[model samples]
Target: MEEKYFEISTENLKKFIDGIITDNYEVIAPTDKDGDTFYGKINKFEETNLDILLPKMSYKEYLLPKTETLFEYSISGVDTEVKDGLQNIAGANEKRVIFGGRPCDAGAGPIMEKVFNWDYKDEFFNERFKNLTIISIACEKPDNYCFCTEMQLSPESSYGSDILLKKSGDKYFAIVTGEKGLNLVKAYSNLFTETAKDKVPADKDWKKIFEVEKTKSFLDKNFEHNYFQERFLSCIGCGVCTYTCPTCHCFDIQDEGNLKEGRRIRNWDSCQFGIFTLHTSGHNPRVTQGDRYRQRLMHKFKIYSEKFDKYLCVGCGRCSRNCPEDIDIKEVAKNLAEMA
Candidate 1:
């Protein structure tokens, strides 16, 4: 909100997006790879995976990263191993933008900013977030397992995007939502044209977009759907769902190698696993898969909603799409709503 903003047609939207990426910094976006779609760096507009509904993993990798060297310490002749990690953070360039991201994924950015920048400031994480911009695109179609409608996020929700690109008939209608978004528009004046006809997207009503919101209002009523346990009874305790969910933000930090020369690494973790909160004192908090499954549903719907006033899910359907047990979130929400 600290900068000027504008709206443009989706046709010229990609031109503006590609134009920004064409400048300094390497651009990355989601792309379909064989049967599995992944997010990676790209050079051209044709390679973007705009049609793929969900990515293989969340965009957490861009912020926290899988493996990182916190700081390396060495000894010359014993009693010398401390060094400043911030010695050269400024000299290196950390400029880049992600194009064609989804509203759900981009929305997680600000939500993530809260906890990451809280307690004690993580300069490493904050530094990375400051230099990057996220351009989220609107979802055109809902997947079978998608429950975003139940969670109050429509296809065009723009909670945490620098720029939001809405798809029209053949063109895209782009809207700048942040100062960074405004900077992108102002920086590339040639890529955009001032439209006088109020360039806001026309067909973005929630009642029109959501087919199940009116009929399947069970999602609002089913806070205590007991059958989900029976439905998920076939689950083999795979963490794939939690891993692929865009809003699931639990992780574990680990140290590998010998004690004297081990590197501290943080890896993606899931609550579906029994050991997620295992105490070092040998008392298991969540003893069974049922407890873990119940925790996941309640946390997403009941807990997160109470805390953040927003459902932790974006309804991208990556969990059900990649789930080996085919546990559909839509079916669960519908049944719960119906039972209620």
Candidate 2:
């Protein structure tokens, strides 16, 4: 379908969201939690906190949960019985709408989707993704940590978003970019208008801080460079970077139960962990923090790009913002570009 545009007043936008909630759609939005803003389920539009450019964490958990059960099994004498966990998962068949996410967060969806469907189709990830609708708000005031423009994406890119919204005075210029967005507008036709308002133009002043292609070239040949060892000396192997990253998809699966019964579960894992690559024979591939950090960079810039023809990062800067060592990925990429 061709793209369609419309304008909606702020009042009607609130009503639209409240109506979605009233209709029993699982609404996920940036809401105030503890003292900071995070993506979480909201009961109404009033609970959303859209004052910030990006939330503390992306809405990835709604699609790929932090911990999920693959299946449950029970042992009876010599026979084993299994049960599909998807049948028991809550909200498995409900539609989910993610509103007020930034473009960087929205873009992570397609990047992750590629990985889930590469070698084998991940039904667990696909089911949630298929039911999700992204309504991202364009960035009006990006902070210093933002580098979406450098990653070949803009604040208003609308790459993975169903509907991209840009606030203009008392209304929003909404661009319906996909089938889901068109269906949403058709379902709520009264909330949107065919006003002749001009769509918000992309920011011309948003500069690209580094050339990603050049950085990739440098990483392609300099896998064992001394820069990795010296630059990552401060890394403490905390795995915080991978946990907060929008595009990191590494996970670990475990079976927990006694001889009677048990369930196979998948949990989020990180390459930064010291034992991530440890072998039962007491051998470790990535022994130092530098080696693990280098793996992280290589996976994001070179490995994934070589396979998917796209970078595995959306440049959301959550790692740098939440890192205890204050490591900045943008600076690292710029330094690699300089080296190239």
Candidate 3:
């Protein structure tokens, strides 16, 4: 497909965003909340905050909520009935824009879509994904833990982004990638002007080198390797990495309420906990922190990729940033690659 480029100054960008608000579409962007940045709902032009680094959490929560009700059931004596639990959001059917998303955050949605659509389709997730438009802001100042380049993705990667915006002087160089993006551009054509693509300097420093293939190969042959036991000695099993990850999608189904009335809920779960794999017989296969940690790495680099032709991780670095023990994934991958 031919790439289309447009230029929009700061003023025009604000106008375009305001137009979205006027049209009754929700705009979610990075915002400062309690001195930390997070993807939040924006009502005005001034609400969007892009000066900070990446948000603490990825935008996954917007699509697959942290907690969702699957269905509701009620019973009185001998009568029992089940009912749908989905409640429509206000203007949910309208297009929602994820403005100013980073490349890694924007790219993770499509990677996760694979599993949700596999075997059985998750209707709840699909509905939100179908109605959403992703607008990515290319990274200019990646931090120390960022290793997207090592995972074969760059700041400019546009795998799941409908539109990509790169800052060029006082204006932005924008590229519309899909039908939704094209429609948005055409609707706001007056705000955009044709321009050349911005030139990225070669001296821009990113993170460490990685051998993704080597890491996968090592895991394939060393399924019983001692490094899994030795490397996770300091792990506290807090599950912070999995919770903050852009790609981890494990969940637990729970029934809430009394015996007379109840709602089945799907809440996010993590493999880091022993109860995550505990059976009714009280036998837990992944009993140790090392075993759980190994499963995390295996699913991310080896198993998921082998099944879906894509790595489960997007190299966003959120896991390393939020890990209490400072266990960096890039460091683990580098050590595995160099191992005998």
Best by lDDT: 2
Model 2, span 97-211: residue lDDT tens: 9999999999999999999999999888888898899999999877777888888798778899999998889998888888999888889999998644355544457778889
Could you say which candidate leads in TM-score? 2
The runs of at least 3 residues in candidate 2 whose Cα sits more than 4 Å from the true structure, single-residue gaps closed, are 76-79, 89-93, 195-205
Q: Lowest summed lDDT over 10 consecutive residues: which window, candidate 2?
A: 195-204
TM value for model 3: 0.93
How well does candidate 1 score on lDDT at residue 325? Answer: 85
- After superposition, candidate 3 runs with Cα above 4 Å error: 75-81, 87-93, 196-208
In angstroms, give how far residue 40 of model 3 lies from its true place.
0.9
Write model 3 residue lDDT over 262-305, tens digit each, in one string. Answer: 99899999999879999999999987899999999999989999
**Model 1 lDDT-worst window of ten:** 208-217
lDDT of 1 at 324: 93
Backbone-clash count (model 2):
0
99-208, model 1: which lDDT tens digit per residue? 77787777777666765765878776677778778888888886666555555666787767787777667665566767787777778776665443355656455552
Per-model lDDT: 0.67, 0.90, 0.86
Better of 1 and 3 by lDDT: 3
